[model samples]
Target: MTKNKIEKIFKILSKQISNPKTELTYKNPYTFLVSVVLSAQATDKSVNASTVKLFKIIKRPEEMIKLGETKLKKYIKTIGLYNSKAKNIINLSKILFEKHNGKIPSDFNLLTSLPGVGNKTASVYQNEILNIPRVAVDTHVFRVSNRIGLVKTKNPDETQIKLESIIPKKWLKSAHHLLILHGRYTCKSQKPLCGDCVVYKHCSYIKSEQNKKNISSQ
Candidate 1:
């Protein structure tokens, strides 16, 4: 995307949500990390439904270790991949206590090295907790960026790199939230509300015209 388009797009998004935050609810960094891990392929509402009770009992790594994998699974069973997620969360919490002195590591490599933590999850942890300027591209950011001509990439990692390079430093922190909210509310995968989209003029997706036609027909 051009510099002007990027700026304009971000400006519109920022105005819509002055302070955008992750929908996943957590009280601290450890809980936040756990929440993001559970959020993979799961809705925030589902994760929150489980974590609201999960966090109350185990807010810290030591607490999570006390909970154990078998028991943790009971709480997160509603989320997809809960069996493995529970195992990873339990093991990762143990590592946090043993290796990191019961603290969530701020370093990306260290964070990613933990069980169940990948690039996307690590970026989210660092960006939200440590105030880093990394773009953690989820499905929302990936689809919206492509549709809006921000990046012509095949995957989230490449799209994240492209966005970080092109997105102005001023908007870097909020880019993830902006793109995500836009996708969730406006530029959805099916039946994107193009007429209501703030960046409709900047979108490059040919399907948007068809969407407008479909809407008008209705």
Candidate 2:
């Protein structure tokens, strides 16, 4: 896409989503990191539901480690892969407490070194906490960016690189949340609500579907 079109697409999305931010709830950086880890392959709603009580008592890495993986699993049992998530959370907490002095590291490499914190999680933590401009590619971001012709990549890592390079720097900070919210509400995986989509005019998926319909009806 042309630079002007990309700029326009973000502008429209910004207008549509007045306050684009993570839906996950947490009290501090430590809690936010844990929430992000637990959110892998899970909904924000589910993470929030689980973290409501969990975060109330566990605000630091030490607290999380003390909570133990067994108790952590009880809190997040409803979420998928809670077994592994709980283990990772406890393990990461131990690393943070023992190695990082119980503080979440600002360095991307150090953050990713923690268990359960991958590229997307590290990017998200840095972006939200450290005020870094990073476009973290989750499922929603990957799907929406590809569907709207933002980037034609097969994986999240490639999509992130392409989007960060192509998108205007001014919009990079909010792009992650904007695309996620848009995909969650309008441009869904199944039965997308094209009529309600603010950027439908710029969506390649919509245009492609229209062309297919026209061809079939001809």
- Clashing residue pairs in candidate 2, if any? none
The candidate that wins on TM-score is 2
Per-residue C-alpha lDDT of model 1 across residues 63-89, encoded as one tens digit per residue: 999988889999999999999999999
The per-prediction tally of clashing pairs is 0, 0
Residue 112 miss distance in model 2 (angstroms): 1.0
> Each model's TM-score?
0.94, 0.98
What is the number of residue pairs that collide in model 2? 0
lDDT of 2: 0.93
TM-score of 2: 0.98
Write down the RMSD of all candidates, one decimal each: 3.0, 0.8
Best-performing candidate as measured by lDDT: 2
- The regions of model 1 sitting more than 4 angstroms off are 206-218
